[model samples]
Target: MTNEELKKAALDYHEFPRPGKLGIEITKGFSTPEELSLAYTPGVAEPVLAIQANPEDAYRYTAKGNLVAVISNGTAVLGLGDCGALAGKPVMEGKAVLFKKFADIDVFDIEVDAKEPKDFIDTVARIAPTFGGINLEDIAAPSCFEIEDALIERLDIPVFHDDQHGTAIVLCAGLINALELVGKKIEDVRIVCLGAGAAGIASMRLAVDLGARRENMLLVDRKGVIHRDRDDFSKLNKEKLEFASAASAERRSLAGALAGADVFIGVSGPGLMKPEWLMLMAENPLIFALSNPVPEILPEAAWSVRKDLIMATGRSDYPNQVNNVLCFPFIFRGALDVRARTINSAMKVAAVKAIAELAKQPVPQEVLAAYRKNSLSFGPDYIIPKPIDPRLRDIVAPAVARAAVDSGAARLPYPAHYPV
Candidate 1:
C-alpha cells in the first residue's frame, strides 16, 4: 500500500472500532437476577474482604495478576518524536492489542498528562496497585531512566520500559546468532553504536551482560564519538558517563570508529551511515541499521559495498528484522506466570538465549506458510524468529520464568502448566 493508503487505513482502523481499540467485557454470566446480585453484592464482598485481609488474594480473585499498565508521558512517541500524551494513546492502545493477541495477556493503556518526571512518577506510583506489571512507553531519555529507577525501587512488581529493554533484547538476540554465523565470539567483537538514546544505551549494557567487552564498545552521538577529550563530554548524562569513561579512545569520528570494527549498530536516523563506511569494517562484519520506515543506509546500498556482512533493519520486508514484539509480550507472560517481583538480568539473558536458539531450530510449517516461504533456516538472512511464531510463547516465556525462580525474583513457583 502507498503511504497515503496506509495513513487512511490506520486512521479508519482506530476510528471505526467504537472510536477506540479497547473495552471491558464481562467475563462472568449476569443473565439472571440471582447471578447479577452475586456478581455485585454478596459475591463481590466476600472476595473484597478476603483481599482486604490478605493482599495476595487480589491476584487470585481479581484480574490484577494478568493485567499490565502501558504507561506513557508521550515525551518520545516512536519515530515521530515528542507528540504529547493524548496524541500517543492510539499507540498505547495498539500496544494493548499486541499484548493480548500475542501472549493472551490483558492491558490498560494509560496516557498520563504529566510532562515533568516527578509528576509522571507520582501519578504512576499512586496508581501502581491496579496492575500486575508496568510497561513504560515513549518517555524521553534521562528522564525515562529516572522514572524507571524510582518506580522499580518503590514498586514490588515488575516495571519495564519496552522502548529501551525490549529493543535491546531483540537486537542482542539477532546479534548473537549473527556472531555465531561469522565465527566471532561476543567477548572479542569490536562494536560501534551510532545512537546514545534509551534504546542504544540499554542495548550496549545488555550486550555487556552477554559477554561483549565494555572497553572495546564505542558509543557515538551527533557531535561524533563520545569521548572525555571532547568539549561536550562533561555535559553527558549519567548513562553516557558510564560509556564515555570506558569508551575505547581509538577514533573520534564515525569513519574512524568503524575501521576494523566487527559491528556497526545505528539507532539513529536515515542516510547517516555512508555506504563507503561499510568497507572500513573488518571482514564478515554485522550491520544493524534499525531506524524505522528508513534505516541509516538501505540494505541494497550496504550490500553493494560489502557482501561478507549480515544486515538487519526494522522493516518487516527485510530479513532479520529487529522487532520488540518478539520478546516483550512473552517477557511479561513469563514474569506474570511466575508472579515475578522484578524482571532481572538473568531473566533477560535467558530470554535472549531462547530467542537466539529458536531461530536455529526447524521452522514450523505454520510459520513458513505465514511468510509465504517453502523453507527457512538459520543463516545470514534468517537470524531472528518471525513475530507470529506460536512457539515463542512455549519457548521464551518458560525460560524466563525458570530464570525468575532461580534468581529469586519470583513471588510464586514456576507454573505446573509450563513446559518442563
Candidate 2:
C-alpha cells in the first residue's frame, strides 16, 4: 500500500469502535449496585489488603499475571529509524492489539518521551511492577541491547526486546527446518549475517547457543564484516566478537563471509546482497533477507540464480516471513505461566526446537485444503510455522515453561498440566 493510503486506513480504520481495538470489560457478573459495590469499592479493598500482606497474591487479585508492557522510546520503529515517541504510538498500539488477539495477553503500550538510555530505563523500571513481563519494542540497537540487559538485571520479571531475541528465535527455528530440508547439520553450516544490529547479533548468539559452532558464523555491519580488525565497537559488538573471534581471520568482506556459507541472514538494510552473492553460496543455500518494506535482496532476484535456495523475508507477502510475532507471544505465555524470573537462552532454545518440531507435524485437515499438501509436512517453503497457526501457543508455550523450570528460572513449581 502507498504511504498515504496506509495512513488513511490506519486513521480511519478504528472509527466508532471506542477509539481502537481494546476496551475494558467486566469479567464477573455485577449488574446490581450492591454487586457493583461489593466488586468495586468496599469488597475490592479486602483483596487489596490481602495482596499487600502477601505481594505474590497480587497475581491472584489482579491482571498482572497475564499483562505485558509494550514499552518503547520510538527511536527505532520498524525500518523507520528514530521517529520519536509520539510517532511510534500507533505501531506500539498495533503490537499491543496483536499481543491481546494472538495469545490472550493484555498489553499496555507506553511510549516514553525521554530519548536518553538512562531516562528510558529508569521510567520503565519504576513502572514494571504493574505487569507480568515487559516487551521492549522498536528501540534502536546498541541501546536496545543495553536497555534489555539493564531491565533484566534489575527486574525479577521477564524482560524481552522483541526485536532482538524474538526475531532471532523464530529465525533459528526457520533455519532448523530449512537446514533439515536441505540435509545440512547446524554445526557444519557456515552462516553469514548481513546486519550487526540487534536482530543480527541476537540471531547469531541464539544460533551459537543452539549448537551452531561459533567458528561457523560471520556477522557484517555498516563498516563491512565485523571483525577484530575494526577498532570502533560497542559493548554488544564485543559480545559478538566472542562468537566470531575464533573464525578464520581470512573472512573480512561480505563476499569473503558469504563464500561457501550455508545460510545468509539479512537484518542489515536493503540491497546489501546481490543475486551473485546467492550464486556464490554453497548448494541448497538458505537466505533470510529480513529487512522491512524491502529486503536486503528480493526473493525473485535471488531465486533467478538458485531456484533450490530456501528463502525468507521480513515481509508477510512472502512465503516464509521471518517476523518476531511468531515467537514473542508464545515465549511470554510460557514464561508467565511458569512465573519465569527471566527468559534465558535455555528457554529460547527450547522454544526454537518446539516450533521446529511443530512445523513438522501432520497438517490438520482444516489447513490441508489451503496448502493442498497430503500431509502438512515441513520443507523449504514451510520451515517456520506461521503466527496465525492455532497450534503455536499450545505447542511452544509448554516447552518454554518446561525449560524455565529445568533451568531454575521458574518461580513456580511444575504445573499439573506441565506438557500442555
Best by lDDT: 1
| Alpha carbon lDDT of each predicted model | 0.93, 0.86
Candidate number of the best TM-score: 1
- Residue lDDT tens for model 2, 38-150: 89998899989998899999899889999899999999988889999988988898898888887899988899988788999999999998999999999987788888899
Candidate 1: pairs in clash: none
Off by over 4 Å in 1: 245-250
Model 1 per-residue lDDT at 43: 72
Off by over 4 Å in 2: 1-7, 231-237, 243-250, 368-376, 418-420
